[model samples]
Target: MVLYTLAPGIRLSFNEIYTSSWEKGDSSIFGERMLIVNFCIHGRCDVSLAKNRYAIVKENQVCISTVMPTKDFYYPRSLYEGIQLYLDLDILHDENGQDFLSALGISLEQIVEIFCEKDGLYLHQMNDTLRTLVKDAWDGKDDIEIGTLRYLAVRLLHEIMSMPAESETETYFTRSQIAMVKEAETLILSDLTTRITAKELADRFGVSESSFKFYVKGILGDSYLNYFRKKRMEKAAELLETTNLKVIEIASAVGYENQGKFAKVFADTYGVSPLEFRRLSK
Candidate 1:
């Protein structure tokens, strides 16, 4: 964790990696009455909210919140890598000990109001511009000068303040729905030899196939068949590189009944045949 205090009440921190379920909030030093901007590069975030509810922040998305979590932030996958910018409005002040935010006018606040949920979180898909800025910062965060950090922080805010509200309605999943999707992952992925159609899986879960696909896309970031195929190909590649199995045997092990089809798909996925991949691994 690298934290840069850009100004009196504004700061940015780089969360490189956290392999834990929960992160105890330590922002007490920054005080309450805060606004947070989270840019997720990978992993998922579960922000504790009022009324025993939690808001999710998926990879490649931004989460803005006006209220700080009362206890800890939860990472459902036990992983989180991202950047968070904190603005403690209560402690924000100028050199003259005045409210410096007044200088920002109402544009910033308007943006916040438009996105912030009531004791929840407002999540947005980050644009390419913001993604590049955040990615560059995350890549060279330690080397950035203080002045440059300040500029980046302000520029990020400015970029966000300029975005118009989204016209498409955002969707929120219940905890039960999320749990159901995770169970589907285990059911299908644990044994790749059998193909499970999305309709079959959804029927087992008692959800519409369309809704099931939506949940999968939102939580896992991939459609059902593609995700399964990707895992199968990855497993096949691993076997080719590590084991002494023949190409046909490796193909069967990864649920491919036809060696010719397997080779074609493997070549498409990795641009190499199984035997060629093995040679390259050596």
Candidate 2:
């Protein structure tokens, strides 16, 4: 993939139909101080950050990230392409920008959570109005026309943020609990290669092991290790679909040293082998 950095603070990086293969086992620390807003225009892609993983960011889906020192990769490899909009906090606070942020119920902390949390995909219906706005900007013939599209893009982001937060009942974790759980998840994902025990995690979070276990189980209805394993497996699934990496390599990247055990667990969780799942996705 071709990488470019537009204007230092506020810029748009566009890549059209860029095709490339991601290494089987690769991870990097994403630098900080920028907001990444990606739009999937032509084909599908997946990204794994921390412990969360997303698949097939279909056309029109927007994925935003603010955290740094993380890893991301793509899968399915179908002409893999998209646009990355990077904005600094200052640009996001312009008069018009302030209005947009208010509309989305966005706070500085919430923006950080959006990127650091596992659920990064935000789905919105592409109605006529939205479609027309996109068409005018992306299909426009010149720079001046394309610049006008930025306003519409801001409005679209507002519309997305304005949508009610997903119902709490729909998620096993309550809103407050989710924040805490997400913080814990970030820790787990940051170093998947190491062995982490529940007691150690509990101490780090300043709670007794029993209380920590209770908190995790109450929200996710599962033990800490189980939840951690699920997150790793989810990351593996994304890699399997997006990269040409072998199953063993993917397994190791997500903290599994035993490929056989990893395969069995993955198949049981997904109802199909990783190879089979990747083939079907393609």
Candidate 3:
């Protein structure tokens, strides 16, 4: 993570090739009163929000939030890249920060009025223009010219502030629900040789079938079978690349007793047969 001070009390951060192992969220170190915008460009992130609820920030999604003191936030995918814009009102309302914001036709009070409420959070899907600006932010991470960066930050901020309110807030699931989904994933994927149905997995975990599917899709961004199949194939690919195991043995290791089906799925995912992939690897 690289931090650039665009303006007093206004900073932008670029995260490149990062992975998180913690599940805690506390922003007190930054300041007491601040607005945060998170641009998830490549991977998904779990955002712990107020009232034991949480939000998921997937690729190409933006989270504009003022509610802090969230807990248990983590990155699902290992490699994550994104940009964070921080506006600490404590300093932004100061003489210099105030003067800077005023010069850009921005009133600090208005932003607070619109985005700050009890547990305020707004999630938006980034379109082409917004995505472009975020890309510019990424491209300018090493830029010595701070003026271009300042413009990019303010422009992205303005774009987010101008978007309409959405009802996706209701889609947020509870922390326990996320926990249940994760535990299910761990249990089912713990042993590649053990086969389990979606219904069985959900019932084993004490969640209803519908709620189970909802949480799986919400957290993993895919249905249970798709997510499991992809995970299996990932393990298969790693084994193929690293081990002396034959293709059939690798299939059983990833829970595929039928070599034909395993070959088909592997081919569909990687655009090559397992043997071809191994031969190409050599």
Q: How many pairs collide in each candidate, listed in order?
A: 0, 3, 1
Q: Residue 247: error of model 1 in Å?
A: 2.9
Q: What order do you get sorting by TM-score, best first?
A: 3, 1, 2
**TM-score for each model:** 0.74, 0.40, 0.88
- Candidate 2: C-alpha RMSD after superposition: 11.8
Best by lDDT: 3
Instruction: List model 2 lDDT by residue over 151-267, tens digit each.
Output: 544565554454344412221323344445556766777877766788987788776899778777654446887878887887898998889999888988888899999889999
Encode model 1's per-residue lDDT on 157-191: one tens digit a residue: 77776555552345666667767876887776678
Which is superior by TM-score, 2 or 3?
3
- Kindly list the per-residue Cα lDDT of model 3 for residues 84-192, writing each as its tens digit: 8787877777765355556887765676666555456767778788999888778766764678777777688677666665524547777788888878877877898
True lDDT of residue 259, candidate 2: 92
Clashing pairs in 3: 23-72
Candidate 2 least-lDDT 10 residues: 20-29
Candidate 2, residue 11: the lDDT equals 50
Global fold similarity of model 2 (TM-score): 0.40
